[model samples]
Target: MDHVIKTLTPAARPPEAPGEVPAAPLRARPSRAEAEAAVRVLLGYIGDDPDREGLVDTPRRVVSAYDELFGGYHENPGEVLERTFSEIGTYDDIVLVRDIPFASHCEHHMMPFVGRAHVGYLPVERVVGLSKIARLIDIFAKRLQTQERLSSMIVTEIDTVLKPRGVAVMLEAEHTCMSMRGVQKAGSRTITTQFTGVFRDDPKEQFRFVSLVRNGIG
Candidate 1:
């Protein structure tokens, strides 16, 4: 009988080296002077006076805000998934968590794409703690992104870290870049989804996962 396993394969060993020096700790981020200058230029190009009192500190505030908004660029996602707990039982049903809210900055217009994510995975041998899923979402969402890429990134990260038999991710969001400007249509939401393994091949499984997220299992 062919076995369907979802275990993490051992990574290939690096070539044996003699006396490899320890790598240096990561250094602090580069100065924001360049970004500040860019902001000043943008303000002038947009016919706004940058030297006015109201706009005097705007560049500095924007620089500081961007650091927090895109802090995920500095985080290591694998470390977030390093710890795990094994579950013992014959019980194997879809584990779904829904309505995980996140706020991400749009890479295109630097506006916000606020949304909720629904994530599900079929356990192969172990289960991750619930909070970790939310943490993973936050880790990825804090970076500049678009809804489609963000949805796929969440699904791929969970698949890589957990090696689940199946994984599904759905995101529902409002893109302020579109609503607050350009098209200027509020109340319109964007939905993006990604699936893999059994969830990709089995429509029923995918539907079930979606139903559970949209409507509670109860």
Candidate 2:
């Protein structure tokens, strides 16, 4: 199947010198009550009584769940990576974190797709905490997204913020939209990987990263 690759620019920084594009305005979100009402409408549209004993509180519960599910919108990926440690000058090698679990709703069907993310980065001058890499994945996964776009976004965020020498990320997921509906192929899985800089230039390093991911080691 043909895949779409979107090339993203580096993270935007506040204008310090001059001639920078100002940040776009943020849109106001609907109130919780409105969101709950919308959910009820959707539940009713699907031929379920929103007022039924079992589902009476489902709308409110769904809205509350969304606060955590789609919370990536309210976060800043740049800020999550702002504090970096360059304490080691000569320690330049690959840093890989494997098997980070994540769950996300597909943009196309709004159904959940669960997965594990494996991330690796080659430090230029410094490195970030291992958990920060997992947090980065969480930031991107909690939004409605395609697995392809999600993989790209993770690499782009790390590339933009850490400014590493090279970065690599891989994600393998089982999309519920396929398993629970439509074609209903229960065991089908999608995998996406990205590499940058040296990881992209040198096949050996790319192979090494892939090997580490396969072996579940740093």
CA lDDT scores, all candidates in order? 0.80, 0.82
lDDT of 1 by residue, 126-158 (tens): 887888889888978987788887887788778
> Which candidate leads in lDDT?
2
Q: What TM-score fits each model?
A: 0.81, 0.85
Model 2 lDDT per residue over 47-81, tens place: 99999899999989999999899877656665667
**Residue 18, model 1: Cα distance from true site in angstroms:** 29
Model 1, which residues run further than 4 Å from truth?
A: 1-30
Of the candidates shown, which would achieve the greatest TM-score relative to the real structure? 2
